[model samples]
Target: MAAAPRGASAADFETAATHAIILDHRSGRVLFRKNPDEPIPTASMSKIMTVYMLLEQLKAGTLTEDDTFVVSEKAWKKGGSKMFVEVGKQVRVGDLLRGIIVQSGNDASIVVAEGLAGSEEAFAERMNEKAQELGLDNTTLRNATGWPDPEHRMSVRDLARLASLTISNFPDYYGLYAEKKFTYHDIEQSNRNPVLYSFDGADGLKTGHTEEAGYGLVAAAERDGQRLIFVLAGMESARERATESVRFMQWAFRTFRNFKLFADGEEVETAEVWLGEKVRVPLVTAEPLALTLSPDMREQMRVEVVYDGPIPAPVKAGEPLAELVVTIPGVETVRQPLLAGSDVARLGPMGRIAAAVGHMIWSAE
Candidate 1:
């Protein structure tokens, strides 16, 4: 008989942000969530999409780092977090990218949008189209600069997803996020992402702020090969956003531990095999199974093998014959395949008959 594992109490961590999400980058797991799906003004975090679109162009060979784009009057005259790009001057694609990422420059974002799509409105339309294709259901783009608009909003979940994609898909360009400062037209500004300066494994991402959105950040960090991407919105101040983000990241890494529960070819259980020379077959996993859990939750973790009884006839080595289900409180259940560890040949005729007779006697008893 198979039994489900015991459940443990959920984590007690709390945060001040109204909307946030923490995701495991490698496994696509949601480590923590709070109103993640609710749409909110993303402020400058929406610039990530603008950057993503430009990276796509770079990858497609339509643009290059050395290529220069002419800054328009609209970009030079734009407000908030200026890259200070002068009108009628051609800036390298690489520098503009750094400006947007390191400086959170609205002007640089608008320049990229206009350079590619010919106008901010047209580029924003493309942004919406790309958002749909990326499965960002709660994301809508009104402009490249993330200027406040009732129509421009993204869910924290979507922001986290975008950050993940940007890091994973555009490794060559992702380094710009870690750059502390960028200089353009004799003006320099520091990267606004709080995690970059204080967090050990922190790298590039974006920060956003507006009267409407308050202060927000899309942040990523990696430690010991594990990466976490998180999004926070509706923070009351820059200090609050910085403090809460670091605390949340610390909790995620410190509280949970990833343990290797099963190694490849490690026998997990013995399953009955009918009409076979061997009465039972060893069941094992073909690959290692690693799970993340808190210490208390690990103590209560359950592992169950589910399969039909008396697997009939010959069983081949490495044949998938059972399921290994792991349950832990406050986390999604993990299912892994259990495979036959060795071959089990069918029983000879006499042996089969004797086994049948023994089975009948056992049934009668």
Candidate 2:
């Protein structure tokens, strides 16, 4: 998916951020992108991953909200944002999550890291391993928090991917990002995510800032039945981060609409079979198919099923046999595989001979 105006062939949307990407959550389509793959300093936005590690444990039943982790001297002494956790005091898993999400507490991040892996270094190792497993090719974790480290980098696209995973895979824990404030030891700090406060449907994600990374945000929102996730980095200030993020989300939701072309296993075309028990086999989509398109492009969309004619016999159900190509004016062409919808048994020896003769005769005619 791509963004374009009503009659333009190229994207017209622009942003002030150094790197960015907007994604349609349901269809997994990229609506807009600019330098999305470049690895750069992530700042505290990396706490989303730190919190994600904890969420995994909670969802898997390995850790409960009541479970406590003793805060270390290092956690208490760490600078930047603070949850005001006391040194040597055991903190609940739930409060630490709020600290990390709502307060952007570096101390809380470290507490979770140390409690889960015995040390920040070990926890970062697990983060790296999990990044690989999640197919985030441009991310590297050097510490538990998104502190200013030279090697602690993540691409805007990777951050969007991580945001998507966090929302879809851990819905129960993802709500923490929407929390407005969290108080610990009489100290209260508001969540750093700007969209949560400004946007209509906005909820989760995280924010980041450093002299090197500037300001960044991973914002998500849902309106009506659609959801979008976007990432931004290298803005000059918090105000710009907030303005651009909300504007981008509004632009994305306002412009593009996701259109469902076919449901899973829905037949799109029928292809002739060669010497099979059946004369033809239905071609169907293996997964639900949807695309994000501007309203203008939607009217001009064209679909085609391309395949070799008279496919060989003994076709098994779900075998890839064709391609469904969708073309929309002013947007990139999309192609997806089409599968055989049902089994088509090969004809017996005599039946094959007779069918071949019939095919030959039909060809002559």
Off by over 4 Å in 2: 1-11, 276-278, 296-300, 314-319, 327-333, 342-354
Q: What's the TM-score of every candidate structure?
A: 0.88, 0.89
As for candidate 1, its clashing pairs are: 177-204
Report lDDT per candidate: 0.86, 0.88
The per-residue C-alpha lDDT of model 1 at residue 245 equals 90
As a TM-score, model 2 comes out at: 0.89
For 107-162, candidate 1 gives per-residue lDDT tens digits of 99999999999999999999999999999999989999999999999999899889
Off by over 4 Å in 1: 1-11, 60-62, 347-354
Give the Cα error of residue 328 in candidate 1, in Å: 2.4
